[model samples]
Target: MMKTFLIYAYSAILVLGSLPQLRQAKKIPDQPFARKAKSIYRTPATVSRRVIEKTKSTVTVSGHEKIPDQPVLFVANHQGIFDILVLLAYLDKPIAFIAKREIKRIPIISKWMEQIKCVFIDRSNRRAAIKVIDDGVESIKAGQSMVIFPEGTRSKGTNVQPFKSGSLRLGTRAEVPIVPITINGTYKMLEEDGGRIKAADIELIVGDPIYPEQYQGIKHNQLASDIQEIIINSID
Candidate 1:
C-alpha cells in the first residue's frame, strides 16, 4: 500500500511541476497548431506513461495499422480512467477527446485540455450538446482527429453498453472516417483492484475505419450501432 501511495504522490508532483512549462506552451506566439498541440500534450503523455509503468500494467495494441493517415474519428469503449492513459501512451496518432463538461472546471488541467483541442459537452443541456458536436465537427473538418466514447460514460466492467448513435454525427458530418476501437482489462487496473494500482494485461484493438461515404444512404444511428458491434467483437 505504501508503494502504491508513493507512486501516486510522485505522479502528483510531476503533474504539478509541469504547470510552468504548460503556461509557456500556452504563451508561444504564432506557432503552428500541431506544434502547440504537441507542447500541450507532451507533459500529460509523460505523466500517463509513468503512471502506467508505476502500476505495472502491460498494454497490447493491435490493428492500429488500420488507422488512416488523415485525421479520423476514434469511436472507442470507455472502461475506466486507464482507458485514457492507455490511449495517451500508446496510440500513434495525435488526437483530442470529447469529455464531460464538469472536467473543464479544473483550472490548469482544463487549460491543457482546451489547448489540446478537447471538446467538453454539457450532456444535460440538449442545445448545448448539439453545439459541442458542431464544434467537434469543425475540428475534424480542420484536419484534427478526435475521440468520442459513444457509450457516454465508462462501463467500468466487461459489458459494453449500447451506444448513443447521435454522437457519430461528428464523423459523418465532418466527412472523416470513424475508427471503432475496443479496450479490455482496464477496469482491472483500478475498479477491480480495490481502488489501487496493480499489474494488469490490457488490450486496445483498433478496427477498420467506417468512411462517411459508406453511410451515404444509411441512417447515422445505424452507423453508430454497427460500429458499436464492431467494438464489442474486438474486445478480448
Candidate 2:
C-alpha cells in the first residue's frame, strides 16, 4: 500500500541523512566510545519516532521509571518487527540489541546498529553462538545496555513463546540487572495485516528489575521461564 511504501521510503531517507552523524560518532576513542554512543542514539530514536508517527500509530508506555541507572539486560517478547522501532522510539534509556547475524548484512542500518554496540549471533553454528554470548557479555560489562528477545524470533501475535535459556547468559555473565519488558500490539502495526502498515495502539510495560542477587543462583532455564511468564502476564 501507499502508506507502507511511504513509511519505508521516509525511513530510508532518515537513515541516509544520519550518515554524517554516524561518521562523527565513530571518531570517539574506544575507551569512551560507549558513553559517547548514547548521544548518537538520539538520531535513530528520532527517526524511529517519525516513522511510527508516519503510520499514525500510538505507543503507551508504563513503568519507565523502573529502569535502573546502571546498564542492564532487557529481556522482552518479540511480537513483530515494529517491536524494535517502538523500543527505540520510546524507551528513555539508550540500548543495543542482540540481533541475528543476517541483520548485519543490512546497509546503513547495520552500520548504525554497530555504532550502538549491537551484538550479532549466528544461531546456526554452536561455537559462533557461544562467541556471540561472550561478545554480548563484554559489551554489557563495558556499560552498554542490551536487549534480547528470548523467543529468538517474532511470534507475530500476542501469544508469548517459550524463551531460549542460553540467551540469559548475557545478563548472568555480566552480573547486571535483568529487566523484563512486555511489548503488546506491535504485531497489529505490520505483521497482523500481512506486512501492510496500519494504525495501531501499542503498549510497552517495564517490569521490575530482577537484580544480580535475585537471579545469581537460579538456573538460566528457570530464569528464562520466570521472565517469560512475567512478560506474558503483563500483556493486555
Among the numbered candidates, top lDDT falls to 2
Estimate TM-scores for all models.
Answer: 0.92, 0.97
Off by over 4 Å in 2: none
lDDT of 1 at 223: 85
lDDT of model 1, residue 5: 88
**On residues 147-175, what C-alpha lDDT tens digit does candidate 2 reach at each position?**
99999889999999899999899999999
- Report the error of model 2 at residue 9, Å: 0.7
Residue 156, model 1: Cα distance from true site in angstroms = 1.3
lDDT of 1 at 140: 75
Count of clashing residue pairs in every prediction? 0, 0
Give lDDT: candidate 1, residue 179: 91
Candidate 2 lDDT: 0.90
Worst 10 residues of 2 by lDDT: 28-37
What lDDT does candidate 2 reach at residue 73?
A: 96
